[model samples]
Target chain A: MSEKHLQTGDELPAFGGKLRLFAMRFCPYAERSILVLNAKKIPYDHVFINLDQKPEWIFTFSPKGTVPALEYEQGKGIFDSNIINYYLDEKYPEVPLQPTDPLRKAQDKMLVEQLTGAQSAYYTAAFSSPSLTPSMVETYHKGLEVLQKELEVRKTKFLHGDEPGLVDYTIWPFLERFQALPLLGKQEFAIDKSKYDVLTKYIEEMKNVPAVKSYCLAPETHAKYIESRAKGNPDYNMLDTSAVCCMRPRKKKE
Target chain B: MSEKHLQTGDELPAFGGKLRLFAMRFCPYAERSILVLNAKKIPYDHVFINLDQKPEWIFTFSPKGTVPALEYEQGKGIFDSNIINYYLDEKYPEVPLQPTDPLRKAQDKMLVEQLTGAQSAYYTAAFSSPSLTPSMVETYHKGLEVLQKELEVRKTKFLHGDEPGLVDYTIWPFLERFQALPLLGKQEFAIDKSKYDVLTKYIEEMKNVPAVKSYCLAPETHAKYIESRAKGNPDYNMLDTSAVCCMRPRKKKE
Candidate 1:
């Protein structure tokens, strides 16, 4: 529960007997795994690390020092959001996040792949405003249009189905954070009701999804973090849960 | 069946009632799908296309015009090697390339992801000789070391156990193509028998894999293609399967 980022030379945290996830407070990729874990209703501990000054030990969990990495056992972990999410779905099949149909599953993965360009577009718009161009905005809208078209074709409440599944959890994080763009004065990134009626409606419904609502950050929070990160200093410890939780990293009793 | 490169104005091939895969003759990513389909023993037709001058129809399959797109139906197709391979495994479960254990499957995916850095290094060394740096060579070896270590730890003949599975099929293409590096005068990219004894032995075993042996090309062939590709013109039709009976692309009877 501690948002205290372990930096270079920091010791690996003691094994707490629970599955652990290493994440950055504001990374959309990391948010993906968290959403899946929450939806699966699994008991796990999360450690938010400062990506700018990554802990040397983080590499033990994530080979590239990127997250979200899942420490499934003592001293053993696997990284990548899709990999972790798939593992969680397969290892704990109670909720079944992935589609049973083989073709549907493949299509789900493709949709996620298709959205990468839009993610790049968003990053440029939010962090490097000057580099933001008409084409980038076009790419961003193309991403939204792809999502809207998929939703229309699927005819489901969520892209997953009547209930949100892997596809839903995988994409929700970006959509959740895209809302922050408008807050950061990037109004072009806004999900307007008129043009994206169905998508905006879907977004409204996702905002209330129990799993999403529980740990979801406000758009304003994401905007603030974006500002900090753009300034070459990330506010990793913005959520200081030390005062309220037993899960906080505390000094050892001598 | 002809290894002919389709260009901008070529007509779309008629639906042949068999699953069709769009691929470049020398593209490693395309080879992943080809190997998987062969391993699965699925009767699929492959359409070799000139990636540089892609047939207009290729875009119908892959939005960005990449190879290894699978047309599962008459006109519908799904792109991305991983996506297509996963679909093949799940849809044709006769010989499952993917492991049933979720953890092992996730680990398999992670291994592929980890090797990507080395892949980039190989690309630069093979295609842009001047940009090749000592660090790129280090990355290339690090990938080999990572594989060798995994082989040792697994104590398995192949990454997928007794039989070559998806993991082997996925990574084999790159290892196959890596052989071309030494042939292309990039001797630094060679997998020496001394330093990479296990990997070399494993590579030897993979070369003999039934599915791989049928389509696997010699290092000389790969090197020749690399030479052409690096010069801005890929020898897409170097295979010249046109003379082979019943394999050449011919006009359908009107």
Candidate 2:
């Protein structure tokens, strides 16, 4: 897995006969599928793409060139995080992430729906500060409150019960990046310890989850990326240490 | 089931122990659930709501006051058409609407995603013609082309199969409403026979489906509703012949 973001004119790396995920490093939606794949312990190849200067090949996997497209078979792709994640859950069936109870599954979907307002608010606050409104800030807290209430009601170690499941993975990415808001000087977006004691504990527990631990970026790192993107020149390859590591002898500079 | 749209002051109808769906008669999303309920032969009560002046209890069923909220239990409600429909499909199990193959299921979802652009274009052309752009028209046609191509590739009577499935039900509501666009003076939105012979034939077949035949409104009726809505005074109860039919003697006007 190379951290380098492939852009225009880049040839897609040869399909390695494993599941391949097309993603952008900082995208939450993309992180969702990645988390699901990791939790399932599915062997996969991750190809990070530069969204701003997307590789032409991306359209083959995702018609809209969006992140989190899964190439399940050679050249055949499934797009949309939820669609891909659901497919993975069903196809593998080894580790079922969704609730078995149909009503419970619908409720889980609703919880995710409730959090969408907060996600939108986070986006506006982080990327379009000028458009941030008081109502959006209120919506953000409302989302957190909804999560806390659900956590208290369920009384489970995770939303899916003893083990983290699809619902948890789907939402964890948003929470991971939300921490960056306060660091970016948006103090209003802070998840206050007192108001969100249960949620805070849950967040910490999620951070320690084996599946989340490996891919979770620190709030400061997210803040740096957010700052770069907000300024228009998104540093897509800022975290690419592959350039620094001399794994093999390089050719002479062109 | 009453065709009259209940407004803010309307009393909450007594739950009949059957699955009760809160919907607005002409809303495509609401119609999606209705079609599913019919297809599954689920015993359900339908309560129509005035979206502009929503019943206070609508929020009890759907927090966002959106339509197609299902009261699966006496008081417990499940919102979102897809969530409700999927829940019904899983819970019932007698008539499974989804594909058995996981990849096929994902592909079905992707097809619905592709049709969204055309749905949006139809909305703009029908509701906000002033804002309609040439690119929107192009996107609308592109969505149709995608659908036609999928139909050709699959070679199925319905997007799902010989029997209409979730994919067919999900996409059909939009196609049903799309017919109204031409009558609403947007001829450019018409499904031309030459351009979409397969789609045209498919649409005709879908119309004949017993579930669709009972619930689907004629294009003229839809166009009338669209006109009323566009004029800012949506005749929510325009088809409420219950008012006209005096099953019992009525008191004279005071």
Best by lDDT: 2
lDDT string for model 2 (B14-114, tens) is: 88989999999999999999999999999899999999998888888898999989998887899999999999999998988999999999999999999
lDDT of 1 by residue, A134-169 (tens): 998999999999999999999999998999999999
* C-alpha lDDT of all candidate models, in order: 0.90, 0.93
Stretches of candidate 1 off by over 4 Å are A241-254, B241-254
Q: What is the lDDT of candidate 1?
A: 0.90
All candidates: TM-score: 0.95, 0.97
lDDT of 2 by residue, A110-149 (tens): 9999999999999999999999999999999999999999
Clashing pairs in 2: none
Q: Residue A201 in model 1: shift from native, Å?
A: 0.6
